[model samples]
Target: MGLLSGRRRPHAARRSIRALLAATLTAGLLAATGPAVWASERPAAARTEAAVAAPGDDWLRTEGNKIVDANGDEVWLTGANWFGFNATERVFHGLWSGNITDITKSMASRGINIVRVPISTQLLLEWKNGQAAVPSGVNAYANPEIAGKTSLEVFDHWLALCEQYGIKVMLDVHSAEADNSGHIHPVWWKGTITSEDFYTAWEWVTARYKSDDTLVAMDVKNEPHGTASTSPRAKWDGSTDQENFKHVCETAGKRMLAINPNLLVLCEGIEIYPKSGVSWTSTTPTDYHSTWWGGNLRGVRDHPVDLGTHNDQLVYSPHDYGPLVHQQPWFTGDWNRTTLERDVWDPNWLYLHKENKAPLLIGEWGGFLDGGPNEKWMTALRDLIVEHRIHQTFWCLNPNSGDTGGLLLGDWKSWDEEKYALLKPALWQHEGKFVSLDHQVPLGGVGSSTGISLSEVYDGPTDPEDTQAPTAPTALASTAKTSNSVSLSWTASTDNVRVAAYDVYRGTTKVNAALVTGTTYTDTGLSPSTAYSYTVRARDASGNVSAPSAALKVTTESSGTPSGAVKVRYKNNDASATDNAIRPSLQVVNTGSSAVKLDGVALRYYFTRDGSASVSAWCDYAAVDCAQVKLRVVPLTTAVSGADAYLEVTFAGGSLAAGGSTGDLQLRMSKADWSNFNEANDYSRTTSTAYTDAPAIPAYTGTALAWGTPPT
Candidate 1:
């Protein structure tokens, strides 16, 4: 599912007799009842600043269902989610809009005492292996000081800024992939990642921040739920060891506690079975269900996870969503706070808190704030939090959530004042003590240091004389080759100070973002049956890059299946035009054995633009048939001042048979707008998958043609 589709909810049960009966009974209740009034008004705040402990003193631990300081005073977590480390981008989202320090300061001003950051295990492994890059464009432009730093180093920078701003952090292992889809694996381990690796990730993270008091806890795995009937290993069984939530939590939690006992172990519930009077058997009917990821805690009542020595530190965290995500049965038919609490809240996981079994943290909860059913749901949820004094974090502080938009909107610079106004009254620390209307007090104060500085933690060089580049690696050779990946090894390079890392490039495109420190590197995610050329460059601690090593080329094995493919060739059509412009032509061909149909094809062209230049428009000069193609052009920024643009031409419902071509489609650009076109620079092409026979495009080459004059 696309990220903009909103958070995916639990799969609805198939229509059956039981479902029909439940719907009929619900409708009957609505017909028999008159209009009812729910306590939708905001509940009065129960505790104030005097009731809570001072911010940022000692490490925190759970004391009888409550988080308390070393002095034993209560500490409430009122924060918002800033997701991204778990996303495909692998960095915080709004860094492009503002600095990390400034963003944290802004959150502090809003009475947010904590920040819940979601991350993925794969990203952690990449960072640990020194293969994570701090993506280019916006991220690089905004954080220029740490432009080439590894992802882990960038994460540390953000943590340092959080510590500087007096904000606590709860790390959430959101997914296995950097993308949004991995959260529903039923267990923390998925695909190439193993259960042992999952545990090891926690161990690494705990050890890294073991002494950092600002990082309070680890929110285990985000929303462990799938088919919960024991088939795919998602059942809540305490006795079983394989794929059991209790077993995994106890194992990982004990290890983490051993490393940092002060850290809280936040365990969430699974969405499975056990309705009302039903027994705890695998087949028991589960009437009530959790709406969001890692939300269904109904099983906690029967089998509360045993965290061993860290049991007291266990916090039962669950996520709740509004009608926008999914309208549970209780949400319909004379629904009010009473029905919602009885049908959905109590049976799911609220009973644990109501029975004083554990401290409850609403790990995530927020919606569009569109002032209707969503508004009412927010009000009721807020009432419960205020009345129960529960620890809470809003779904996000980002503007990227397609479901629950953010507390900040528009250019990401301005606050969603409406949300701030709604949430401020419920904050544990209001506008005076820990937070203020004017300025923020750094967590331990302005000069207080945690002994962990950027230089102390990061591997990048801190001195000036290390500017010399490392010697270029020698004898680069392909050790192994596969259809989708190539493994290469080369003689290590030496530098004046030390060779920090090596970069592997496929043609002119850098394939790996994280520096390769080892003599060997494996490049994955390649096209089958394609020839690829590689070069390696070494860099020193001071960011000096060496010249590329000798090139090594290899061809990957084929799939053996007859498939269609698209190949694009570029040529300088004209350069002597009177408008001081250059005309480029693209020849697309069906290079594969099968017929290929295309809805569209796009090319990302890179060049150096003149100072203070801008693209007025892209003009179509010629094509095989101009009437059969619709052309669109968009300008993009590849670097701080570089000109990057993509030209997309959509075909008018056509297909190119085997060895056929799109003839020549020509485009014109003003030389006054762009100069120094880097034809040698790697360009990108994307083929349309709209047709069943649209095979993946094989890799093509871009040539650097001489630029003197147009050919006669």
Candidate 2:
């Protein structure tokens, strides 16, 4: 893509080719752009683009990774991209000759029930500033209906056509500017167009269409891309920087949703992601795995987009293309679906669907080379999409797309019969009729008999109703207490349906502003020495709440001395939550006035056994000797959040002299089954590689707690 087709920017040199090809349409009109076979595979009747008096309440939300309607019925969005609004044309291409009415209806009748319209932020801003669009891009003699209308008006007209034909609309901010080759630029902002401008443009448009159910989604940005060595390159990260695509998408998506809560927010991935052991600092080519622009989603494994309360409205849209666009490395060898899924799709984007992280839409995928490797890749992806019910939008409707030719032939009136044949199986169909995302409206509306609405296909919800509640959380107990706060935890609850949330209660009043999704919770803002009681209840997706668990009462520690003289410093040998073994090196310093006997001291390293109860340990080395150290894993009698078990360390031989130190006692712990541990929430676990004070790892002198805070 010298990364071509990704930004679709001379280096989108590909756009020059597309621009030149599109320019020729001004002369030949008919001779240069004709379908291979001018056969009508379409339904007998054509639908008109008349405005609909009643638009369906067809807004959708996600369940697990499936897109479900208001009635909880699953619906697939089989769509195609109609470019030009994002380009210099400032409106849909092929409008010069093809009637927008005919094309929009043709899509609904032929199974393309949704359209992803690419538009630039600059054009939206121009419309926002009341700038009139020039009519040069529109051939008034050929299609006079929208002749004198502004670009915004033309888009509104298209939205009306979609509503009448039962085709949903999704707007994509393809670039910061209105230039034909704007995608070539990497980030969302450029020169005069700030990121705020990009966001405000969306707010204005969303406010305009808030009542219209026709436009259901907004692709936060087109293809945020650039290499590690390139400037203005987009990176997928947790940072709030301008170059961080994740933050930008979240910021923009949240802003749009604030205006229209029903809109599906599509966040696309960036072009490149750092490989294992590599950071953005590494400029070497091998340090990263590059994908088609907006296609690499590996960063999601670690830094997922946090929509907070609006997570159900989030969808991940990744764009993929065939080798004909750019022969990426995966295409180098003989590759099939299995290989591609393993090497490319799974790591890049497919995992989101598989892991139920989010809904995924292949925002761009289609090309002209239907004979060889390109078609092979396309065919494989099509199968995956059909089998998994993943949402998608094929690349172009205009043949002007340089790398991936249009789904329609150059003439723009006829569909590429061969390509449509391959894609037909992936479309949402019931019996012989294609399905519409709308509930009441039939696809192609009243004129065509080829399609059915979401209700017509399902008739009722396909999934069984979830009425059962999750089990109450078990073994709720206080983990730690401070002068001002108290931390609590419990065993995870089981649910017949997904456990949507955990509600924590102080006495009888709910203390959390939002439902807690995890087992651990820390309640702060309390009076020192005051008594408190806490309980937790689990809730399922259907709004059923389980009975509250047994309550635990405790009094906060009064303001006093800073605990004991025996202090502990620990270094995490491995910080991965899924690591096979936890290796934490412990060092104990004796700050007491007299010598402390090793046999009388005990250090508890709190962690989670993670389901495997049978545990073992190894004393890699000790200050005295490896044989002198004894390690025992003990599950907590009353489970507290983050820490379900503790590794008790006792010395068999060795005594700490006054003002003496135990150099380094390297220890390792693991379950007998060798299953992984989730150390992320462990109270004593630290991500720091260097040794630091571990107040969470409580120490004791005989029966008295000596150091740090222990679970009450």
Candidate 3:
């Protein structure tokens, strides 16, 4: 049955003699007189129950109240947005069947419960002039390059699949050609059907889904264009456009009620005055572009004749975006606590709810453009939705390769783990329908926007203290020996909350630090036969640290060389002892068998003045810091054949090797910064080792091989 309208029945038959006698008896019974009763004492009850149950798919009209299951329990709709359900020619088309099912089921497991199906009227009726065939494929979008399948056929199949997954579907007519909403409109809506055109289309789809409980409400028009003053006067005819909407809506609502009055009727919001025009910047009106909320839609405050019914069985749908408020001039220019609450958000709510007397269902609001998903905005939006009991369907679910708008990609064959991780918790759920304290704030408060706030929602796992497992108390380390340095590695600890990073503690203090992107970590720089206890701790994104992992006792193998001496000498036949003063030459020799890693290297040299050692220059060589800089792979198993040491030299005002001279020289490393190449646990260089001799500068006798900045 269509939403708002209840089922109708055939004419009732009346009895003759028996009916007459019953009427006579009823009259006598009233004459017998009744006990005095207070009119105010009349028991109260809801007219809601006796009314034919509303269709389960009418999510918008119900406000926060959800359709109940057979058990009479509220059922929240948690599903993906199928914005790609248009013609096959569309690039972001979503493929259906097993793959979509698999992806959706995964979503279901993650707590998703409903699907918002976006379809273009043009695809359904325009292609075949209103008659079409359905396409077939394991992937809907993957239907072979055949043309026979019509949009109607495609939708029928789509609905069937939704049934298989036991998910409710909301068929949204994204656009209308006559008014030019957003999606391509069918030719029928392009000034073809007259005043009854919209109703006719509604009847066609509604009648088709009459018996399908899974079919939800229908949206009249996506985002109606033009306002009263700005719109053409003829377009505002009493029998068409706004007027026609009321006429068609009531008539269709009645017809739908005859079938099933349970269906919900959804209406999209208009762009009010002064709203951040970010979402509509490209298509904003030229002269009468809206700047006030209630002033735009005259009929809303005045209840124009076109708004079928009293706005009781209706839902108000609006769209919001972050860049509109955060980056645009409308909102950001005069941004203040008062402006955010009253000028920005409150007016929209007042019109949709107070004036219209309908619950709002945010049809589309998401991260888009280069703005991406702003967690701050998302949180605020969520809180506002929850506050008003407004339902919402994120603008898209597929990877929006064009303008930003998807939580996932359309490929459907694979999954994006990181994206999923970032979005999973932020996903709106059927449970906890109300805005929690963490996500709300009073108007004019110290928050992003007054009346709602989305900041600091993720404060780490608060409930279930065992969320993140603590690091082990004991330390376990595995060591490897090399001619220059000893390398050690260890395992990471378990945790309930996600581990942000790991710290490697030598003896009692942390010597190496690495981010916990994966499992293993390696430590360089060690003395033979030296025993050390390395502890690891798991930290959260908020900087909350967990107990240290078990200490792993490791002992390095002794080498023949002295504990911490490193010498540099010149190599190559063209080099000489005096080259140290001219071009400079040196080599690092580790006499010790235990492998050693110099976290950083620095050098002090003299350019012998009158046979006296004098300081000429100094240098520090180190790695550059990057967001994920801690991620690196330093080979600890280098062969003694010159591969054991990492070497490089830098000069000021360009390099002498480049025919330029006079510069400081030094060697530098992360000072035991753990690169997350291996598991977070690894050995670290403890003792400071230095090489006094400087390396010989390469001769620039020949053409330079495209010299550039050195890798920090």
Best by TM-score: 2
Clashes of each: 3, 6, 78
The list of candidate 3 runs beyond 4 A from truth reads: 1-80, 87-92, 96-98, 126-130, 134-151, 177-188, 191-195, 227-259, 272-299, 304-312, 324-328, 333-339, 350-356, 369-375, 414-712
Q: What lDDT would candidate 2 get against the real structure?
A: 0.75
Q: Which window of 10 residues has the lowest lDDT sum in candidate 1?
A: 32-41
In model 1, pairs of residues that clash are 87-178, 166-443, 223-294
- In angstroms, the error of model 2 at 449 is 1.2
Measured by TM-score, how close is model 3 to the native structure?
A: 0.43
lDDT of 2 by residue, 13-108 (tens): 323432343243222211211111110111111111111112246788887677766644457889899999888889889988888888888999
Off by over 4 Å in 1: 1-57, 228-233, 275-292, 430-712
Error of 2 at 361 (Å): 0.4
- What are the Cα lDDT values of the candidates? 0.60, 0.75, 0.38
Query: What is the clash count of model 1?
Result: 3
Point out the higher-scoring one by lDDT: 1 or 3: 1
The TM-score-based order of candidates, best leading, equals 2, 1, 3
Candidate numbers sorted by lDDT from highest down: 2, 1, 3
Top lDDT model: 2
Local accuracy of candidate 1 as per-residue lDDT tens digits, 1-712: 1111111111131113213322422222212111011100111121111122222333677665566555343456778899878888788787776566657767875667778999998887786676867564236665564567656766766665565455678999888767766665667777898878888888988887776666888998888776435455455666665557766777888999999988888988776644445444444233323344576787777778887767878998888888887765445423346445654677677776655578889989887877888877887887777655688889888888887888888566788988777776566542133431101233332432321111111111134454445588899998755555677999887553477667788898655422355788777557789999999887654444677899999887575522224555666554332334545566667766666555433333434333345443353754557666655444331221232443434455577787987776666655455544433332331222222221221221111011111101
